[model samples]
Target: MLEVNHISLTFNEGTPDEKKALQHIQLKLNKGDFVTVIGSNGAGKSTLMNIISGALFPDVGKVTINEKNVTLLQEFKRSNYIGRVFQDPMAGTSPTMTIEENLAMAYSRNKKRTLKLGVNKNRRAFFKSALATLHLGLEQRLNAKVGLLSGGERQALSLLMATFTEPDILLLDEHTAALDPSRAALITNLTKEVVEKTGLTTLMVTHNMQQALDLGNRLIMMDKGQIILDISGAEKQALTIEKLLHEFQRIRGEQMGDDRAILG
Candidate 1:
C-alpha cells in the first residue's frame, strides 16, 4: 500500500554537523500490513516515519501510496494521504480544545468546510462511538479540556484522532513511548484493534523488540539508517528477541547489546 524507494537523507549538509540519517533505504507495505520497525538510537527509525509523513524530505528517493508519487508533496498535502501520531502526546492534539471539538476538526479533514463549528447530532454520535473504542470514558467527557487529561489518556485520544479519517497510511512514531507500561500496553492493544478494524496500513516505530515481534504482521530492523533485516508471516511468528538480536549483529556487523532493545 505504501513504498519508499531508494531514499536517502543527510542533515546539515556541507557543515561539520552534517550527518547521514538515511542511506538508500527501500521498503514496502502491503495492504493491511502492520509493520513494526525497531532499531537502536540513530538507526533512522523516526527519520523513515518523518519522510513517510512528509515532515522531513529525503535527499533522494520516491514515496508512493497505491502507485502515486508523493516524493515532492508538501507536508500538509501528505496529511491528506496519511495519518500520524507522534512521539509527543501534545503534538497530535490541541490543548485548549474540548475532546469532541478536536475530533470535529479531524472529521472535517478532507471535506469542504465553512464556519460551521457546531457538531451535528449524527456526527456527535459517531465521535462518541469512536471515543468509546479508547475505553477512557472520553465519550462521556466530550466537553472536558484535552489539556486536563493524563499522558496515557491523551495518547489514547491522539490515536483515536489520527485514525479519525482513515487515510491511506498510518504512521505511528513510538506512540506509546510516553506512557507508563500498563497504559502503553493498553494503547498498543488499541492500536492493533483500530488498524485491524479499519484495515489501515500502518508503520509503527518501536524501541521494544518484544513489542515489535508481538504486534505487527511484519518486522524490520535497522542500523545507521539502512534496513538490515526484514521478516514476515511464519518467519515473524517464530521470531524471538534473542533471534532478532542475533540477526542484527549478523547483518550490521555490530554488537547487539543496545540496552534500549534488550531492556525495553
Candidate 2:
C-alpha cells in the first residue's frame, strides 16, 4: 500500500536549465498491486520511482507507505519498507563480492551488525536455497565473484536479493532493459513469478510497449511530467499496443510511428 500525494519535483529551478521533472503527480498503489509504468524519456517515470524509494525528495507533497508518512525519510532509512532493482545489473551488486556475501549483506539489512563477515551455516543454507530458486545454477557458485556472472544472472540475483525480505513496495526501474531479448524475457517472467508468489506490491518502469501490456494488473502512461493515461481492470484488459500508440500520439500531438526508438 503506497500513496503519493500531490508530488512535484524540479531541477535547476530559477535557472537557465530549469526543468520540472514531475508536476503535481499523484499515484496510489494498493497492497499486492503490480503497476507497470511506461513513458518516453524525460517523462518522469524514473523520477516517480526515485521519489517513492527516497532517492529524491519531492519539493511538494508527501509519500505514505502502509499508512506511515515517509516523505522526509532518507533513502537508506526507507530500506526496511522499500526494495529497488536498478537498470544496471552492476548498480545493485558489488562486483568483487561473492554471491553468498552479496546475499548475506542483503539479508542483514536493517538488522544489528555483529562485525562478522563469515556466513553462518543457516544463513548460507538460506542463500543457497534462494539462489536455487533463480534456476540459474547460482547455488553452486555461491563463493564465485559476482563479476564473473552474466548481466542477466546478476540482475536475477539482484531481484532475489531485493525481494528476500518482501519489502512493502518493490521499485523496478527498467530492470530488464539491459539484458538481451531472451534474458529480458527470462527476467520478466521471473519478476512476475516472484512478485505473485510473494504478493509484493510493485511498480515497474518499462520502455517496451508489449512488455508493459503483457505484464502487470494496471498500466499508466506518462508524458511531460504528468500522468496522461491510467488504465486498469476492463480498460487495460481491452487495450492493445496499436491503441496505446495512437493514444500517445493523440495526447502528445506528435508523430510517434517513428518514435518507437524513443518509446521502446
Candidate 3:
C-alpha cells in the first residue's frame, strides 16, 4: 500500500558538516504487510519513516500511497494517509485532553469537524469498545486525563489513537523504546494485536531483536541509508538473533554496533 522510490535526503548539502540521511532508499510495502526495520543509530531508519510520513521531505525521489503520488504533499496534507507513533509517549496525544477527547480528535482526523458534541452515544459506544480492547481498564476511565497515565499507558493510548481511523499506512518509530521490559512487552503485544485486527500496513523501527523477529512477517536491516538485507517467509521464520548479528558483521565488515539490540 506504500511505495518509496529512490528517495534521498541530505542535510546542509554542498557544505561542511553535511549528512545524508537517506541514500536513494526504495521500499515497497503491500497491503497489510507488517515490516520491522532494524538498524544501528544513523542508519536512516527514522529518516525513511519521516519521508513516508511527510515529517521530512526527500530532496529527491517520491512517496506514494495506494498509487497516489505524495512526494510534493506537505506534512499536514499527508496526515490523511499516515498514522505515526513516536518514541516519546507525550508526543502523540494532548496531555490535557481526556482519553475520550483525544480519541474524538483521532476520529475526526482527515475529515471536516462538526459543531456537534464531541462524544455522542454512538461515539461513546465505539470508544468504550475500542478502549476495552486495550485491556488497560481505560474504557472505564474515559474522563481521566491522558497525562495521568503511566508511560506504557500513555503509549498504549497513543497506539489506539493512531489506529482509530486505520490509515493506509502506520509508522511506528520505536514506540516501545522508552518503556521497561514488562511494559515494552505489553505494548509490543498490543501493537501486534491491533495491527492484525485492523489489517493495516505497518512499518516499525525497533532495536529489540526478539520483538523484531517475533512480530513482523518481513524483516529488514539498514545501514548507511540503504537496505542491506531483506528476509521473509520461511527464511525469516528460521532466522535467529545470533545469526542475524553474524550476517550484519559479515555484510558490514565490522562489528554490529547496536549494543541495545544485542543485549535485548
- lDDT per residue for candidate 1 within 183-220, as digits (tens), equals 99999999989998999999999998889988979998
Encode model 2's per-residue lDDT on 137-227: one tens digit a residue. 9999999999999999999999999999788899999999999999999999999899989999999999888888888899999887999
Off by over 4 Å in 1: none
Q: Best lDDT goes to which candidate?
A: 3
Ranking by TM-score: 3, 1, 2
What root-mean-square deviation over C-alphas does model 2 reach?
1.5
TM-score of 1: 0.97
Q: Which candidate is the best by TM-score?
A: 3
The digit string of per-residue lDDT tens for model 3 on 1-264 reads 899999999989989978988897888999999999999899999999888888788999989999999998998889898888999999989999999999999888778788988888899999999999999999999999999999999999999999989899999999999999899999999999999999999999998889889988999999888999999888999999999999998898999987888997
After best superposition, candidate 2 residue 241: deviation in angstroms? 0.7
TM-score of each: 0.97, 0.96, 0.98
List pairs with backbone clashes in candidate 1: none
Provide the overall lDDT of each model, using Cα atoms, as 2-decimal numbers.
Answer: 0.89, 0.90, 0.92
